[model samples]
Target: MTRFAPYLFSLMLLFVAACGGGSDQQAEEQTADTQAQATEQADDVRTIEMVGIDRMKFVVEGEEEGIKTGEKMGDYVLLESITAEPGEELRIRLTTESTLPASAMAHNFVLLTMNADATAFANAASKARDNEYIPADMEDQIIAHTDLASGGETVEVTFTAPEETGEYEYICSFPGHYSGGMKGILNVEG
Candidate 1:
């Protein structure tokens, strides 16, 4: 009976060890899955890449660069309209593809909120040369913007879409670029 007792204790220990090891492995797997999900969510932000061409046009990457406007608003041309879900994350990357010098030709992305006067904002921005053509006083009207991108340079900005569904205007704030037709619309849908 004593010998049988030792064998029974040994079997109990092995069972406990096996069960404990399995729980630890399960915990590690769960942690790995959580980290993978976090990484995937971070990568989910949509990226929209466009180029500022010589004709004052913002052409979506891989799209035709010719000056084609879907609609014209005063001096600004609606080159494109991109859609997004409300509160979705967005990353806008703007690159300058031109042969002209920076002083002669540069570009910037200025996204204005709905209800904001885009024409007035652009006019104010045009005079803000000391501040990279971004009007400091009217910054409240802007939802997002990027730094000036000169020829052969690139600039990027990331912002979350507004919760309210509406059309937001975006334009190049370079002195005469907006008037030359460098603008688009960001439509946020419910």
Candidate 2:
């Protein structure tokens, strides 16, 4: 009975080790599955490359240079207005090109909700340097936003377009930049 007891103990140890190994294997499988899903979701999103030029405009990458000189919107010009199908996943990559220091010049892509007052939000944001020029009090007004991108730096934000069909405002909340005409529109269509 003593010899059998030793054998039984060894068998139990092996069983415990086997169960631990199975758990590890399962965790690995779950991690792989999650990664695959993330990749697939990224592939499904439409990505837009926007450059914040020193001229205080958001230029769409690969677009015709003439677009920059296109007709001006009230108090600003729309170098480009993004058009998306309602509820579609979208990614906005914002790159800033400037020779000025970040303190003197920076940019961010702030997409505001339909009801948000873009001008007022920009004014509030200018005072929020501690929050990356994003006004915490007006957070509810934003749909999505990227971190401030300094010269030669880039930032991005991914979000689903509003389900409603309408024009949403997007702006750079940097001090005095929005007034310099650093704003555009996001047109969500059905």
Candidate 3:
């Protein structure tokens, strides 16, 4: 029995080593799978561009002259109004065209979340000067916002749409711009 003990100990060591190798292989395969999944998720991200002109208008599709006064231009393209599905990904690109400087005639896109009062949000945002007209304390009410853009400059923002189906309001938040009808609605469909 003493002589056979050595063989048994060697067998146990071999078994342990084989099990360890299998575990390592499994771990490597899992890591590879996770990396592949991450790559695919990154590919799923999409981008949308919008151009704001000196006439205080946005172009949705076709040539600049094709955009009518009140009409839906294209799918997922918003000129005066925007619509989306709940939980959709949104990328807003805002470009301004004004002869004034950045400080005088800048533009930005500020999207408020559902149930947020647009008038109240715009009013509060006007008071926040250091933060570029965005209220710091009321961040929860904002869904997405772009940086301020000057004449001939552009700004962008990317965010996931809200999960609720409702109409959310968006405004320029540049002092009296909201009162001047520089506001739009983002309608989320059920």
Per TM-score, the best of the predicted structures is 2
TM-score of structure candidate 1: 0.70
Q: On residues 1-190, what C-alpha lDDT tens digit does candidate 1 reach at each position?
A: 8979989999999998877755777899999989956855878877776778888888753433322346443333435877888998887888888788899888888889899988888899889999999999999999999999889998988899999999898999888877887888888889
Q: Tell me the TM-score of model 2.
A: 0.71
| Cand. 3 Cα-lDDT | 0.73
In the predicted model 2, the residue pairs found to clash are none
- Quick one: best lDDT, which candidate? 2
User: Each candidate: RMSD to true structure?
Assistant: 11.9, 10.1, 12.7
> Can you give the lDDT of residue 156 in candidate 3?
83
lDDT of 1: 0.82
Candidate 1 stretches with Cα past 4 Å from truth are 1-42, 63-79
What's the true lDDT of residue 6 in model 3? Answer: 95
Candidates' C-alpha lDDT: 0.82, 0.83, 0.73
TM per prediction: 0.70, 0.71, 0.65
- Model 1 residue 33 lDDT score: 82
Residue-by-residue lDDT tens digits, candidate 3, 88-185: 77777777767887667777888998788888888998899789999999889888999888888879887887888888887888777777667777
The per-residue C-alpha lDDT of model 3 at residue 79 equals 61
